[model samples]
Target chain A: MTFSDIPKFKLKEYSKAPELSSKTIAHKPVIIVGSGPVGLAAALDLAQKGHEVTILTAFDFIALGSKAICFAKQSLDIFDRLGIGERIIEKGVIWNIGKLFWKDQTNPVFQFDMLPVTNQKNPGFVNIQQYYVEDYLVDALEDMDNVDIRWGHSISDIEVRNDGARLDVDTRDGSYQIDADYVLACDGFRSKIRDSMGLDFEGRIFEDNFLIADIKFKGKAAEQRPSERWFWFDPPFCPGGTALLHKQPDDVWRLDFQLGWDIDREAVLKPENVEPYVKGMLGDDIEFEREWYSVYTFQCRRMNRFVHGPVIFVGDSAHLVSPFGARGANGGLSDAENIAWKLDLVMRGIAPRSLIESYNDERIMGADENIRNSSRSTDFMSPKNEQSLAFRNAVLELSNDYSFARPFINSGRLSTPTPYHDSPLSTVDNDEWDGGPKPGFPCVDAPVNDNEDSNWLLEKLGNDFKLLQFGGKAPESDLDVINIPIDSLAAQRYDAHHGATYLIRPDQVVAARWKEAQADDINGAYQRAIGAA
Target chain B: MDKFNDTVNISGHDDIYQMIVDLHADGNEEKSQKINAKLIIAMINQIGSEQIVKEIIEMVRLNEEKYNPRSSTH
Candidate 1:
């Protein structure tokens, strides 16, 4: 759908919830706040596993604007598991190469290719509006019987106890209380739930303000533009600042112009003021209309801990990072993926509650990495002081001449899946192995033969604990076993010997690996992976 | 009169500054000064470029001379 055709703040109809007396209060197994992408994905995951989930949100509609246009392949894989991958891939624009240009330079300084592997199931990144992703996820959630998504329900008060969390939610009719076994806060950056709990989101706020405008241009000229991420340190078109151009589906493009902190925000947002900037970049020949516009300041911050007793923060509620790397929604989706399985296992009594602690450890590390990369990107793009400016200019200048200096030019590192190398659940390697994913890393997808059927290795290993034995006899175990031939891509990727075995976790992360298969080793690894050992 | 690399080498000065601040957190100024001096020497050795080291030293000296409390009008 075109940008103009997309509805703006189209609120869904939410039936008024019954008034609650103290005795009539309902206790839910899981209560998710905010109907954003993270909450919707979490609810769907928990519900698909036969758990009841209640989603409470103040707004009934999906987010307005094309706010968060980029979705990483790792996130798409998670969405694939959630049953919306095909729809998202169909709707989103896929691209991998990004060109970075220096100020007043005619040619790009550096270019990066995110997905070097052509055989992967998903592309490196897809550019789709955030609202469309939420819409697809919400549609999926509506079909499930185990999920109850309550719209227009604002959370006014929250109380956390040892056993569970009590939330006082305000609806259109009246207010009601919900006693939930666990609370997942998918609320946006300005989270009231986090504030009520006295948690602090601590980090730096950049002084630069970026104006994002989603513009739609019809006909031949728009179609001819390269469908890749284009970033400029300073162009003659937009002097003294940075600008970014990203193509979305349906003849629309997202343009971001960095306006220094001192400019008048209201005056700069005017159509007249915005037109000149667009005209300067694209020339007067192209006829385009601005679909949406917003001014945003970058902030890199996160809570000290994600898990606070029975209440846990997910997505933007837990952490906020600068938008340079497209880490916001993609990071939130990863949070949902990390927490959903742990919460499901805990709720089903399959694993201890302590399993959730690893979610905090892993996601916190992910957040810190994102913050560090984004902070560096911001510093390079908008130098804070004279020394930084000098260094950035020198890098830009030298990048033209020397290939070694090209690495120093940081536009945005771009988002990549965070590797949980130091995770507590990952078993330390005991034997020497060649080139493959180490323990604690997410499984890389490769083509494999499953019973004469060609399938992706990741497709065969769904969201479950499985033991993969490459070129070896299948050991007797309670876990599902997948034995592949010696010469397959799976075997090659794992650097597998005749009897090498890998213990894959429910989240598709390699928990442990052994040079030789042993039933005892597999059992021990499985137990430790699920937090039983 | 040494010709250095004439290229930007040190990035993330804030992080380096923060590390030094953390190192001097014990409130021992004399010890901190000694540690800073040792660190400079170690870094210079690691860099292994006499011209670059001399240029850096000159740059720091110039900044110190310009911004020192005794030299400031206020």
Candidate 2:
């Protein structure tokens, strides 16, 4: 796309911290590279734990148009403790429904409403622009006395040895060397930290490029729906065409369209043609004020190892997904929350450094799941060849008629978090108790939680290591767990499919699933996850 | 939600995937006109070129009535 002809639009800017009070730099333990979601979340989590934390960002925090929106329930919960979720929720849109369009037909085919409610409070997700989430996190972190943010600074070089990590950081003004006891590489896909360490990023590069445009409605929207998400499948405006219509918290709409790999970038980006792309997707009758438009390639690459020595990668630095499943940022934030708590434990000497291993164990599974789901979604949207398209069409054709088969048709390949069935760090305890929600988690709104003030249960549980169990005495052990005692009636209804109690790590993946609670069970699971047992 | 397991089930597939990517400015003091232009172009280009021109036309043509098209887009 040509850089010129970029239209004027409202830019949500974040202010940078002018200076950090001088401190004994050598005493800091954790240093995070990249102020992206991953770095920010990790820093916030670490800083909150009373660890000496510092972050180096290449650009001014507010200047970067962080390409993310909305935190999944798992992420929102983390923000709650950081005291930022409230402001974010206020500024963002809460959308539980997504509508799709096929040839001459409008359908809300794949609604997340079908996904079991997230613990009777949060549904599957929430929608807010990434910038707002970052702004909130950065703003909150700014006030903290323990956290130091170095803006306009980049990691020029990294040295990993027995003595923690030595980093040569550069700024537009000058360069300096910073040392830390541990490093969290929250940098993005093109992570300098990951690269300097000589790690391999393995995955398929999606040959397609995706374009995103944020616009404002000029009039009544032709298909104004509360779903918060809309996709188009069949002809008229954009058939087999991929576009995302999302509502921002500020009443602005975010439109994402895949412009194909072969389009002439310069011509398509011209002021004249840019409007047509908008007109075509929204309909001839609708008009929009362009806010911002940019193009990106669809890459599904992830680093082979998320953790390297004292330096661990979080967020996009660990994995990069085509934004299809809305997994990239949310997934990254989840990484932060997961590692944050664990690292806090390890640093405070409550848990061993091996606890950091679970960070990889959990997020890689998350990465794999998000990648597969996103890849599936992106594949459906772009459909590599004619055969895939035909298969998709057949699914769509049978979608309306075949109630059982509709998901394959209506869901334009969306990515969701994945569960780990085999984890070396997590145990699979086989005790015989009535089943309920397994630990690694997709929160369900059981009928029992209705009417009660269940919002707190949903908000805080998964943000940390949550231990959920059905009736009977809570598993007595040393694991840091919040007991989610459930009644048998609700357990039976959900348990016909539910297994035993689950041990969920900070990232909200089942660290262990048990049928019944065995003696010393909680400690066993904890020992297995963090080398305590 | 399409049940992949007991809890987390991601629904809807046959349609085009629509993932919304947000662009934010944290809290900037300087009005970086160049930053805006660069970001606008970079973001579009970052996820650019899905080759959906024909598909977009078909969507408007077939679902013109069903989709509540934004007037400003047209």
Q: Best by TM-score, which number?
A: 1
TM-score of 1: 0.87
Candidate 2 residue-wise lDDT, A231-298, digit = tens: 76754555456667777765567777767777776676565676776787667777677666677786
lDDT of each residue in A278-329, candidate 1, tens digit only: 8777667889988898899979999999999889899999999989899998
Per lDDT, the best of the predicted structures is 1
DockQ of 1: 0.04
Checking candidate 1 for backbone clashes, the offending pairs are A103-A234
The segments of candidate 2 whose C-alpha lies over 4 angstroms from its true place after superposition are: A1-27, A64-66, A107-115, A222-227, A400-405, A410-415, A439-455, A459-519, B1-74
Q: Give the alpha carbon lDDT tens digit for every residue of B1-74 in model 2.
A: 21112243456633314221112244342223333433433433333433443444455576875676557765
Worst 10 residues of 1 chain A by lDDT: A1-10
